[model samples]
Target: GRGQAPATGQAPPPEGNLRARLTSFVGREEDIRVIGDDLARARLVTLLGAGGAGKTRLSQEAAEAHARVGGGWPDGVWFVGLAPVDDAEDVAQAALAAVGARDTKLRGAAAEELRVLAELTSDSDPLHRLVEHCGRRRMLIVLDNCEHLVDAAARLAEELLARCPGVQVLATSREPLGVPGELLRPVEPLPPEPALQLFADRGAAARPGFRVEDDLPAATEICRRLDGLPLAIELAAARLRLLSPRQIADRLDDRFRLLTSGSRTVLPRQQTLRAVVDWSWDLLDEGERTVLRRLSVFAGGCALAAAEAVCADGRLDALDVDALLGSLVDKSLVVAAPGDLGADGMRYRLLETVAEYAAERLAEAGDDKEATERRHLTYYRELARTTEPRLRGRGQRAADRLLSTEHENLHTALRRALAAGEVGELLCLVHALSWYWQLHDLRAESRHWSGAVAALGPDPFA
Candidate 1:
């Protein structure tokens, strides 16, 4: 997800927002191929991910690689950024302006044909005119940041796909476009190796001769804590001009404060980690917001049943937790693993950075913090109490696997219970987990919690 990896040799010609990247694009070789393949067969393809997870960078690279390969898009690859385009109705005009730039790069009959399109920019119905022009042209139109005006983006994509015989679309959105034939591809966070490579690459770019191996552990931890998000990694790398890697890693607890001063040229949201998340946060409705913040109580992620128990009351009132959680997942505010729990059991999580954002929201919104956590504590403690017996015989393996997945939640509940001076709940939790802990050989952790249960009181996150 390196935004500006320096690709070797002749790169795709720059156009619209797809400037020939100044740096070699990193770690999306497979993605580029997949996108190219998808576009070959599908008319509409949308890249989906949490904000700041490199959807834009990946889409741009994929589109560029497709164009670089040639023969696929004879009219060229075009990128139209819908981020600054505020209204749905204006999507057509913004697109016309973007694709109109294509005319300048063409020659002969192709150039003349697009020149006709450039002149039609002022048409009374720009969409129809634009579609009529593209009706037979083989081109890749990259609709960037379409989540905010998704309905319009979807409608536009649908019309183009249906009417234009040779047009293909590559859209980057936090959510799916919901168009019938649209392909949704999730751009995940970088794994350890690539995340470290990205950090080292950006770190050296920020400060000449900077090396990640000089302080491998700190750099590793920084990437790990940032959950391998490229924008976050890039922002942290920028701090190398001033701070040591250790210093940067140490201050990441206040990341929104420390990871600042990104390149001022990009959109304000892309310029800062907080702003990037804020853009996504602003897109959510109140129910989605509530479920998101409350679910932040889970140290890792939790099953839907656990989410319902912990987040469905309070201001959520009669709203269905399942639907709310699903909406959050659709919006990319939450990540769901469909098979983690069982056939139909989906486990959901927020990215650690996004969890921090949700925690901040929880604190800012007030009293729901304690109420939601209390429910979380109650749910896990009761789960422990119930699962205790199941740990003994015929059900031991099933129970152990389930509890293992929830071990972080159990530990989280133990700490929260201790902080709140709920000695009674703490005792029950420890007593229930005592054998499970020993079974998993968590001697030290067992000792720590068993000791804490005896010593109770103070210190837990809000």
Candidate 2:
């Protein structure tokens, strides 16, 4: 499950400090369509995506749309915001409060006090009250920011879905709850056209008469560079008051530094790209964090075997690599996609902003940067040498495709090998990849590596 929904949109209205946003909702037509269909069919639908991917906003849109269509959720849509609540035990109480289901007797009392009074005098648990209040009441429940309290939210959702047949849950989280009867919808960045439209809309609002047509190319470039992430694009557009769209596009090379401004009223974790990423980073255990940092060493992405060879060691040994990698993907810290790596394998990657954050973490780790780089260099070197043979004969095209997908990683590895003066590794990599370099017409890189090999003189053994 994604988690609980936030208090937004007209159906739920603003109550109990739940204020709607001033900015207009942007693209996500496909997301809204899929989630609406899921809600119609599945009882539990989770909107899963990265922290700033606009899961909550999409959920709000879905709920409002459902309300407008008279989908027969008689009790209406209830949104429970769990971002501010840290303790697992508080999750149920937060939901109850969101739905206005807390005991009426202690209405004006402090929340902690209300909890104590209810626990001491009443035999009913918050879950029981929620179940009783919502019994036979057809309604949709939205859980927002469930990543931190996933266990508690999952348990609550499981019970609610089981006991209340009339209740449906739509949650937004960085990952799913992995519960039975759950539908996971992966939300992605907007496409180029919608991204440009969203930027235009917000950019005009940010600076009166900011004509998107005048800077259409630069604005498109901005969206492309930001990978069409809603929050990132919004933050960049917010800068139009001070900087030109071209400046925004150019400065994106250092996104963390450039995309720093965010509305102070929002959560600090949501104020900037780095802050959103940090919220996810702070959730990882030591092994996951270590693997994430190490995997950032790869430029494009890595296959499972490549990841195991480069990232697994010490506490995160080869045996644990698969599970750890799976966990990262589940948590949305890493993305999994089908690739040309191999028939049986999938490629995994960090988004550019995420990879940048991991690189910062690696720089700060200071424990085994050298060792990790050496392993990465060694792994890719051996990989090239072993695969070079396959690049001949009938299998040539397949091998070429595989190497092309890994070209960025290969370049990064070779650069490190050269810098560290690993003569054996450098020579072997150059010899193995020369055909690929030539096949792709990378004349300059081919010449440079071949020249370096010749400068190293003949192999002593031959």
Candidate 3:
């Protein structure tokens, strides 16, 4: 049942085994249409997103939709699951088995087909034989879970796209295969209405009499707190069998503990909130993990210089921060966006769930949480000190905008300083941020910060 070649004169299977789902597919009609359009043009299309963002489920739905639409991928849509297979060398073999597995059913030669399928290509190269087999068929091959063996998957996709004129590939991965002409579609979290609908749908399924309107606000807040991730919503909905929507929303700080009700039929990683992220966390190298762990200290996301100052050390140089951050982004562990500054505007952040996991990792690793926070404190203190002067000059608006961006970080640093009784640093931060705080009209917050500073017994610097 490993990599095997088709028997000569063995007829091709008329169609594929993209399994029909039992649950109602919700809130992704537009996404389905977009994927249809992308598949219409690109030979290789990868649906990229973090684990449990429902890429595989979405891909299956898209394939089924395409099959119904017809005229494209005429031979059929074949699903080759790469999740259970770990070795890069075995990907071709798994694919060979999947495409041929369907055919064995059609011929009604189950016993004979198994024998023939097992006999061929056990000695020869399975990949070369697979490409040859697919050479003539017009089909869409769904390559699911390629992130674990990305390079090999890319090679297989490249080979098929180059040699098989009629075959198209629709892949689902946490990252791209980097193959030429590979169309990438990033799967984002569901929006509010859709997220609520999904939560309510799954929640009612969990408890027959459950209604989101029973606790509308709490239901909406639950979706918001979970970042609208479909898997998280489903897991939370499963809690309805025991807890109320309000109770679930309140316990999200312990989401790893609370949201464990995933489907038994799915992969183990998909069976829990922590397990979903743990799968991604295991994929990172040491340097990437270290950076990610340190990054958890940040409240609002940081810019390049902030990350370098807070995250880098002797093991990982300041220069490695950008590359590692970019790598994390590529792997879907981090989210990056353009900020207020031009050219140097990319701000990097983790999802709330991811940041929580990284924090847990940081604690478990015992990697100087206070030191990281202190560096975070020092970085923003200097930023505020530098920007304070610029705020009165021609660069006033730009400086204010930058300072405004770090509002949460600045407040966090201020609170940490006050807690540490670092009165000297506390005073400097208060002074530095005082102007920007006033400009932003945070008088109540300003008064509270001033009062905290005044209550610090005596001014050592003075």
Leading candidate by TM-score: 3
TM for candidate 2 is 0.89
Residue range 1-462, candidate 1, lDDT tens digits:
222233434754634446766765667777777776777667888899888788988988777766665627777778888999998999988888788766654555776766766686867988897798789888888899999999999989999888997888989999999999888888888889999999999999999999998999999999999998988999999999999999999999999998887887888888888998899889888888888899889987888778889998845653478888888888888998874557856788989899999999999888889988999999999999999999998999988888998989998999898889899999999999999989979899889987887666444552
Count: clashes, candidate 3:
0
The alpha-carbon lDDT assigned to residue 56 of candidate 2 equals 86
Which ranges of candidate 3 are over 4 A from the true structure?
Answer: 1-14, 119-123, 459-462
**Total backbone collisions, model 2:** 8
**lDDT of each model, Cα atoms only?**
0.85, 0.82, 0.87
The residue pairs found clashing in candidate 1 are: 5-23, 5-24, 5-25, 6-23, 6-24, 7-24
Per-residue lDDT of model 3, residues 33-139, tens digit only = 78888887788999999887889999887776666656277778899899998899999998988876655665566788887677545648998878877899999
- Highest lDDT: give the candidate number: 3
Better TM-score candidate (2, 3): 3
Point out where model 2 deviates above 4 Å.
1-21, 101-124, 452-462
Please report, as a residue range, the 10-residue window in candidate 2 with the lowest summed lDDT.
1-10
What TM-score would candidate 3 get against the native?
A: 0.94
Clashes of 1: 6
Ranking by lDDT: 3, 1, 2
With a 3 Å backbone cut-off (N, CA, C), the pairs that clash in candidate 3 are: none
